[model samples]
Target: MLPAHRLPHLLSQAVDLQVSRCPYHFEPHPPSFSSQIRYSLLTDHLCPRSEFPSETVHILTAHSDEVWFLVFSHDGSRLASGAKDGEIILWDMKGESPKVQHKMRGQTDGIAHLAWSPDDSLLLSCGREDCPGAIVFNTQSGEVKCRVQNSAEDSLTCGAWSPDGQHFYVGGTRGQFLECALDGSVSSSWEGIRVNALAAHSSPRSVYAADTHCRIRRYNFQDMSYDNLIEEDHSIMSFTVSRSGRNALLNVANQGVHVWDLNDRCLVRRCHGVTQGHYTIHSCYGGLNDSFIASGSEDGNVYVWRSGKEKPALVLRGHSRTVNCVAWNPVYPTTLASASDDGTVRVWGKEKAALRQRQLAAASEPTGITGNGDVSESTSERRGELGGGGVGGLATSASSLASEQLDESLSAASLAEVGSDWQLAVDSLTSSMDSSVGVQPLSLPSLSSRPLPPPSDQLPADEEDEDQVTGSISTEV
Candidate 1:
């Protein structure tokens, strides 16, 4: 549920008004439940604006080499970004200035992926190619806690924390997926298979992992047994689970992003125009209950889409090289972190362009759930529930702590001197936006996002032989 203080302002927006008036037309799911109503109320506010983020505020250089992955800690107190030069920089998110807490580098392999433990204490860094091992680091002291290496020749590609936070699951290309203890000891295994990505769920007690062979399987988490499959014959690069843990956003090789129904094992939606052909371009669920999806593209731009829309609603263009990944701050709804092959990590939030739009909005209309001071019947009921300290209030209390963290984080003032092109990008975006437009990269030569199709004689690889799969950045398909 939205905070009682935030509700009135959220409901007054143009997008919210339109969605609320004709619920069936705007959202895919019916607003049959109170939570759904709250979702619609907050959707447009926290998401990356169609106004786009080009120059409002962001870090110009957070790494010396190309960045591969970035993830915010659970409590949102810290941000860790891994680079292609085998460097991991941990940033302090508290206060106005984001300080670099640690510039960690021990292993030789370039960083491929990173995951934070449930409590924000331990961070797992998975390496690339030659030495595809996993390293666990103590977040507080910036010390190496443990290292997990593959027993065989396959690269250790992915790792994820269990819901309980006691253990983590690790897998890789042509390697057996294993469940390991905190000390990097394998306790259980799912042998003889290859997994490109993994997302563990607690409610359904299952693990949803990519098959890399145009399929994603829902495995029985307990026994590590295969259960169901989401079938779509497209090469999958990576994935991010939805906030509800009921769905998945998959980065398919040539066909953009696909939302898979975890429960039903089918394609729910296809978010198009993600230029992901030559690499493992990662995408993430961000912006208030995963209401928005942001993806890195080969064309050096970040494509952001509202969860309900199939096309990109906001295009973040700033990186000189290909954007590799994006991570939304968990505590602050509007803040976003993006990594790129330009050898930098860019942070985005409310700044000049965003503030200007807000200022105009404030002058134009008084946004409130109770328009003209007459609250809707449902909204009135919600207000009463908040007073009673019921579900709505409890949810508010949980988020209020997160809001407190937001009050402490770096402001948009933390920015490098932006060139005039930044303002032009923002001004052009603010004046107009066509959600139907395809992904367009700025200041870059046009290249086909499509990959060269596979050979006619080369048959599709089975699950075991997926390492032979073609068309990937550094063999990460």
Candidate 2:
């Protein structure tokens, strides 16, 4: 039932070409009607970091039960998470700290994995209910953007957006994967064994689907048929391609992480003993410089590793149960968020070195530098201090004195040039900092000037509107 506009493009492949049997294969499961265990969103009652050993750093909790899947925005400003209890929470991860900004509910049955549009304005979530499947709403505006009934079929397991975001591919319980347009129409599908995971090829709008029987097949978006792709000896729990689309990381159940070089179509490297538990690696994503790999395990840990390293860069330990999904921060490469069966979501980062690199890279961006030259002075002074030579004692003393004078001169110049805007900003910032530091300072933002969005008082009336609004046509996918 693809939209009229897209049918021509989608059906062209089936016209003259010999229809090939779907090469993707998977293990068979006896048909049963029982539902999977549902998890709830985490509650705020237990602190997020309590499950971990650290204390100074606080955790941001939003769900009251298990989080089935979580993904960060393309720019990393926000996060979208779906729970087994049919709750969808959107978190603002930017600013000095992170907080849950919105919670959406519409799907009666628990939601499965979710895919964000490339530009991050809209989200598409699919699940099963009365029949086999239903796709419903959990968007930013709370609008039910679109809903689809799958001719009464089981729920879809995983899905991925095409690079252009105009279309998406979904894998279903019936051992088939289908491609459809955003307008709610199935364009094409390959009927096969149970399709567990699907990923959009990095270079083309084409897609790759992995079945339960350890087979991976590629399909060209231009035509809806399978292309010969690589396969594994065991079922692939997860797979991620590098930024350059040259290499891939594949996680097979109980087989650790496998590195496949797509260029050569051969296995290049493998890390042993990564999959200790029976749990599958739900998600595999590339990290900073495309040198690192980030994975969430059913064993309840988020592990970060490099290409050649036997040991992991960081092992994030927090979730009480298995970690089902994870997403890397696009803007902050070292940061990753994980959702667990224990109903908690944890944001993990590599050690100090990684954090330091991330911070430096962040600060180096033109947009990162803000408000006058106040912060620049501090950075410049530190660089100078670090670069200073180990000269004779008297010369070192003279140089040190000269550097101190230069610092004072720069500081004065910055203050003078900042003018009124700088003063007001500095005062507001200092006041906030003082409060956080346990020292009362100056006044806060004027209540009249900083009007908050309609509070909980206005939420009830807006609830319907918020839950059903879709992004503008101009909105980023």
Candidate 3:
């Protein structure tokens, strides 16, 4: 016994309330037939989807020898890689496919390390014994703009350009750390225990040098004095500071990588299982927002571990020999590059259609039919029916209709019209299921359409005795 005006308003309120509460209590009742169909469609839309795993997108293989060091310019447009064959290759990464833009030959022995100037106009390279101590070259022209020679017999281990790009810090195998100008003139020299690695920090205006004696010393350019930052049990071969400069990743020789909190001056995390037996392998931070750490393994694979996770997230197999270095493109977060003794740099990313196929495959596992025997078909046939565009087409049409209806005013008349159209659309969909015409079984796109290369082409597991030499410039006085 409701008033005419109150009845319509009350009915609308009841409908909205029921619609809002339906999703919470919409569990399928096996005891009912219509309920099962509703449940299947609802679950298909509501179920959480899994993400696709990243895969290799490209492989760069221009270096004949093992690639040792890789550094991307600040702008992330160019990547300079130094190989053991005394060659530095500049790759232009701005294109669809990474292309080798220039190749600069280093000394006969090889290029040990490479550092780009802050302005990306110059590149500093260190070489092995018998090669020049340090060379500052024009990045655009690959011309040796300046050369620093401490001694004819001295070998350079690591080098870093100052924040201002006016000076250079070059470490030698003979425990000699020399600060030189852009013109290769030595400004100052610090005689210390064998310096293995050097890193420059801009905020604090300091340079960090790791020595063979298991200690890291921070040298302040302001005071021109050095203070010990960290002292561990194992000899530190090389280290990379985090982008924030609040943490440092130290490569402890024979041991795994260790993360040190620069702010608190304490050990944060230890990423182990990266086999480091006879040589020094580099580690880098990558993944979304540098939340993961990637490193080379002596077992001929690339290992990636989340920041807090103890176990590695993925052990990528590609390198036939030791993976000497791993670099993530700064611009493209998904793109990763790994250098190996196999003389190749492989790029890893995700494929789109493969992702969709995986999603469809996972969705097909849950039985969409009810126990009422309305559909007596095998799972494969059911999958084919779904893939043939029945459910997808229905969903698309329903969504389009809903959107078109929603575009109009949400008055009572409009709502009634929309409800009528929706009921008719559902009825039409159900009727179409009785006939096979225009029904394409739901199936993934043919794998042959965009087939991936064979596994052998992606990750070569055969280990040939390639002359693998430690490109680390370690000179013992």
lDDT of each: 0.62, 0.55, 0.63
lDDT of 2 by residue, 341-442 (tens): 877666654323222322332344322223322211211122232222223322433433333332333232344455545546456556555554333353
Clashes of 2: 26
List, residue by residue over 1-477, the lDDT tens digit for candidate 1: 766646544444554545433211212333334334444332232222222233223353547788899988877878899988888888886654356777798446688888998888888888775555788999889999998875647567788888878888778777567778899988777776678888766743356678657677766657657865676677778887877878788888888888877778778889876777758888888765667778888887777776777756556666678888888887775668788998877666643433332233223323211112221112112123223344444444334333322322211221112232444433344233222222222232211343223222122222113233211111000
The superposed Cα distance between candidate 3 and the true structure at residue 328, in angstroms, equals 1.5
TM-scores vs. true structure, each candidate: 0.65, 0.59, 0.65
Candidate 1, position 128, lDDT: 70
Q: TM-score of model 2 relative to the true fold?
A: 0.59
lDDT of 3: 0.63
Using TM-score as the measure, name the better of candidate 1 and candidate 2: 1
> In candidate 1, what residue range of length 10 has the lowest lDDT sum?
468-477
The runs of at least 3 residues in candidate 1 whose Cα sits more than 4 Å from the true structure, single-residue gaps closed, are 1-17, 20-56, 150-152, 203-206, 352-477
Q: Which stretches of candidate 2 lie over 4 Å from their true place?
A: 1-58, 106-109, 128-131, 134-138, 202-205, 276-278, 350-477
